[model samples]
Target chain A: MTTQASSTAIDAEAAGTVPRLSLNRWTFRTTPVQEFLEATTSRGIEAVGLWRQDVEEVGLDALRRRVDDAGLRVSSLCRGGFLTASAEADRAAALDDNRRAIDETAALGAPTLVMVVGGVDRADKDIVGARARVTEAITELAPYAEQRGVSLSLEPMHPMFAADRAVLSTIDQALDIAEASGSSAVGVVVDTYHVWWDPSLERAVQRAAASDRLLAYQVCDWNLPLAAEPLHSRGYMGDGFIDFPAITRMIAATGFTGDIEVEIFNENVWATPAEESARIIAERYQELVLPYA
Target chain B: MTTQASSTAIDAEAAGTVPRLSLNRWTFRTTPVQEFLEATTSRGIEAVGLWRQDVEEVGLDALRRRVDDAGLRVSSLCRGGFLTASAEADRAAALDDNRRAIDETAALGAPTLVMVVGGVDRADKDIVGARARVTEAITELAPYAEQRGVSLSLEPMHPMFAADRAVLSTIDQALDIAEASGSSAVGVVVDTYHVWWDPSLERAVQRAAASDRLLAYQVCDWNLPLAAEPLHSRGYMGDGFIDFPAITRMIAATGFTGDIEVEIFNENVWATPAEESARIIAERYQELVLPYA
Candidate 1:
């Protein structure tokens, strides 16, 4: 599988095409939606991962029309999961917001609604309990997503964000939740930046694939000394310690033909012009990642 | 097991005693070793986990004699594993240093030498390769450690440290490595700050206990907005989002009677006077952790 995919990707690149490349808009958060879409399309990138706030900025209908006009595939909606709210009102608001995110995902024709399960609540030291709440929330959202013909792709974030951003911190845990949701709408993402350090990644990815739950394959490098914001510390592929060939091969081996999205969260990358960032993403993805994926 | 241990701890604390509270020296790295020891003993902390640099400062023999004279139990040595060195000479030197650390652990009458298996090498991007090297190093050191009657405790550091500090990033991975070492001298440390985010932690802790590989239980809280030096970002037990009672119960349920070492690495905590830090450790451990442990 890897051999065939590697050769095909190489052949396509040699023919002057960026194969399987998708630009996740957060990679250039400074760019407005219109320009970001224009930049992505100008570079021949056919797909993008959209964030909820960005969608809201232009309004979902306007953004959907623009994405359609650009002929860009919405790979996956950027978020909709903070399900760890302890207060009844907050929990309701979160779920209601997630429901709206699912509607937006369906409207945008995105197959998956990327979910970052909420971290431990303030005044709640129970991470396990918080994870349980996330699981429950996923169960609740799964049916709605299935009804909308969209999948809820659970993103197990880096454990550094486990306390305050997302308690779901491993592919195994995400897969478990996805399976337990018992709705085919539930799935898991294989984001290199998040799960690259995972020891059982190959096995987890295999399991995710076997279960048909591998929704998105996002690429980014894990950088050091973490940015002052930490969340924006991700580097461009090949610029950091992640062995893209090894990890990408593992994902590619799963026979996953999904868009290979570049979702770097670096402030430096964000500061770069969208076109330049798109060019680098294509270049790095071809050199470091495409051969494997 | 949890009920009995929990009640016993509660009873002990009700009698005005801080049970199972061992002060890990790095908690207050600013204090001189002599004053650190004095402060520890003065606070009625019966055991301590020592750092190699601190021991080297006063010389091993002198520190050993002083600890013995103070009637302090050495729970475990701070560290001895940088097995991710890619060069042959560096690898040999790291093993030799670990052997010396095993000797130091024996000399101090500490049962275990904590091992922080190194992260990716300077020019290497292969984390999986680094982990395999760490496993090989542990296998090689196990017999020598067994000869010295000191266990090599593999500590799975937080994933945040996976890039630059330790590739060993989960309790399950550490336990797997320990088992593969095929020596009783190989064990694992359960450090809350590192593994608290683990969704499989309870099961992993149980596996460690079932295999009799639970060598050390270190307590510290997971603080956010990580300090500039992330290594020093750990907070006092109750100050962060970690649910001490829950995590402590998991350890205590393992029937682990070893010293529950307090190993905070926060700058503010380090700046506090050693006496005050010790007092706070005792107080926090008793309140947030002891009953569960």
Candidate 2:
């Protein structure tokens, strides 16, 4: 793999076309890693956000080589959080796992590790305590991630997912935890699907940018009649209720010149051919997101 | 119905027990209004928050007489704000409907009119604009409500409902709108199921109380594996992940000795006999919430 810091530049063929748009691998959920990379590159897409499973499936080194060969940069790792487990042993195991994720992110040359911090344990009812544990875990992991030259990107998932996916449900809350970590390695992800409904979003985004904690931005739409599988409810830009222009303007205003990852998790989206999905994502990015960005 | 203002004291039998337990009519969703009122009173419930449909179905005067006969005080009215319509005529209609609701609340002797402010219109994608519209509508309605001695209680819904139900999805946003209204008639409702995931809830509650905007308190559990129909996903107090004691403690700390309305919208709870549902609610309130309050 080319040993350069993650680049936001598009490949020669894709140069000058939505350069900051990265096709998140989960958008092609069922595609093989190599094929997804090929499809993304063939569609003039120059970067991607990979999941741990995708790296593990083809072996990390091989995946990294394939990504490099395709002239694509890794935007950010899919996840490395789940640190809200209550048991000490479980919490410790989670931290060890996160450290491993940090190494993988570094090895891939990704600058940030997207973290979907854990929610309340099924057996536990203390969400406040669970959230405190998440803050504590991030504080402990921040230094280790910093030592590896990686940033821990805290993702504030939608409130619907607060019970099982992530306790950090707003950008402000993520910023609070990130600030408390007292390490530059700690930052926040502003994913439109999770935060588009926030009334305080403008202020939160400004605060995140002011503190230099706005590390990555993800785009997707918040569709209605929520999908049967809530986790997979995201839709392509402009296909749902999100006003990408308004939110994108806020991100652009922050001077955030980074990859804007398009991460859709809908089952219908997964059923599309990877090339078709990539093509549509690029076109939608041009019409809906790029103007504001 | 009892002619005096909404009372927090439970009926004689329930007074020494859970004195502030108010049975929200939606907990008996499918039950007839008269029967629901009788079931609530027989369970020693002294107060109730009602849905407009419940009053209209039986005729407002008829329902009022039924509530008075049952020795129940009307705690609050279920709704009165869908003011996010983009069209002038639609918005005007919404305000007119809200005025009617306020009059009904006054006639029923309820002190508060719960407002579920409308979300973005299905045909539109301007959530920011929609939210602004909500603020404006409430500002216009607050004075009308104040003159009638009714407080317009803004119920900030869960973000999942931000698309089809309410655009105001956080207590702080509701407070901002309420405070801006510059009317004592403007206030907020703290529903545990909606605000439980908010990391800033403790501070929000404190602020709401300090400003005397804490008009009502609603309780219901946020159950996992969300129901098939999300609108009907609420469970009884002890049946889900919410920490009632902690949240209740915050309200108590504010000296909010107001009615604690148990408002569950679950299909399963509705399937249970009305009496049985009321019994379980009273039992759970005592076991999980009363101790803290």
Candidate 3:
């Protein structure tokens, strides 16, 4: 329940070993699971956020072994819970998929599973209805996630993604659903790229922290004049206009000492050699994000 | 304070003559003011949202006379405020320009002057500071706008444009500033292109309308997978996935009987001849927007 104003001193670099950056698999999503794992470890990163795609390819158990052997903690699982389907069969299927994601998160020893609750139903303009469905879906999954020791970290994507990706576009909105669920298993992801434009973000962070619902924190720059494939246009830390120090300061004020994942989706960054991408992430994370964290 | 639930019926065809559309000057930004004026009136459109560039070229008096001669109403002025500047001189300069804009809006018989309250200062990531400056700048200009009988319509642009355009990114946030100014002259522009993704839009529209602060409503679909120059990527209705009928229904619930401006910034739409663009806009307006409003 920490709502401390952002600290102005004790820079992460000077403090040392405290505020380590986590790498999400999506950053080097183009690379093989094994190669990516090795690259992250070689850089001495402490934790990673795993997308289901990589785990599926390598098989969950084998992937789990790889993460454990590399001494990397899973900050959160990539995603689960796209509960906005129109069909009876499809809606039921989302629950099953989320159940699997929770099991995998628990299996990987990850405390949280990031949930980018899906977009509205086809031709469905009822975002309210779609959002209601998300709440209902999470309600259904909350118990299962709790049973599996996995928290559903609802990730509010940028509003630009509201149409095609996630209808949840603000931390406070995600927190609203989290609160209504009445379960500790439900939480919110305070991703900088997704929420930097939020005017009430500082207060939202305080609210999340007070409720102890701040689950995972992700970082990346918002590419100015947003890129075409918005899912892929996220810039490395210092490359865009986001005020990392300020945003990270908000998260830090929440007393959230969890992994700050460098979850970028830029095409150009991903197109580069995986190793190079890892290096850039480390540099930016230190220069722009770490000091503030 | 009409807090009635959104109207579920009275489709535009049945309601008729009410909720007339306003053609924004930027839709045909390349065309001469005279040509643009003729194209709009030819379609029997009753109102327009004039851009400053076009109005400047035609000279304020000539454009005002032309609008008057055609019996077309000026829905609102294109823009006035850009107060985000690090230097006091630059900011003072913006205030000077906005005063002139307020005078022009008065001369043109427009009730409101849209203010894209500036973005972050140079190399400054402090969006919070920039947003504060907008409130201050608006407070400074609020009296001038009121004296001229023109409301300062603070437009909350889409978050994508937050870096380089309006720091205000939500209807409620805009209304907060409008309310804080404590003046009838301070109102908000409910531009769908900028605010369609807002989860709080429906409620904010009602709140603004209740406060009698909703001075304008601009319509344009968000180009899915936002375009490069977000400033110009706005799509004609139906070109993107915005649920206009639903959004307009929300606005209508607020009892906002005003011009719905078709303010597309799409390069493709602009590339079309001004007359054809008007034709397309009218078609989309009738089918997508008018039904609900």
Which is the winner by lDDT between candidate 2 and candidate 3?
2
TM-score for chain B of all predictions: 0.95, 0.94, 0.92
* Candidate 1 chain A: 10-residue stretch with minimal lDDT: A1-10
Clashing pairs in 2: none
- For TM-score, the strongest prediction is 1
Model 3 DockQ (Cα-based)? 0.61
Q: Pick the candidate with the highest DockQ.
A: 1
TM-score, every prediction? 0.96, 0.95, 0.92
What is the per-residue lDDT of model 1 for residues B125-240, given as tens digits with 9 covering 90 to 100? 88888999999999999999999999999999999899898999999999889989999889899999899999889999999999999999998988877888888779998888
Ranking by TM-score: 1, 2, 3
What DockQ does each prediction reach against the true complex?
0.82, 0.74, 0.61
DockQ of 2: 0.74
Over the stretch B198-267, how does candidate 3's per-residue lDDT look in tens digits?
Answer: 8888888889999999888889886656666667768988777678888888887888888889887777
- Which segments of model 1 are wrong by more than 4 Å? A1-7, B1-17
Instruction: Say which docking band candidate 1 falls in.
Output: high
Task: Judging by DockQ, tell me the better candidate of 1 and 2.
Answer: 1
Per-residue lDDT for A57-172 in model 1, tens only? 88888899999999989998989989998888999999999999999999999999999888898687888788888888899888998899999999999989998889999899
| Candidate 3 chain B minimal-lDDT segment of 10 residues | B1-10
lDDT at A140, model 1: 87
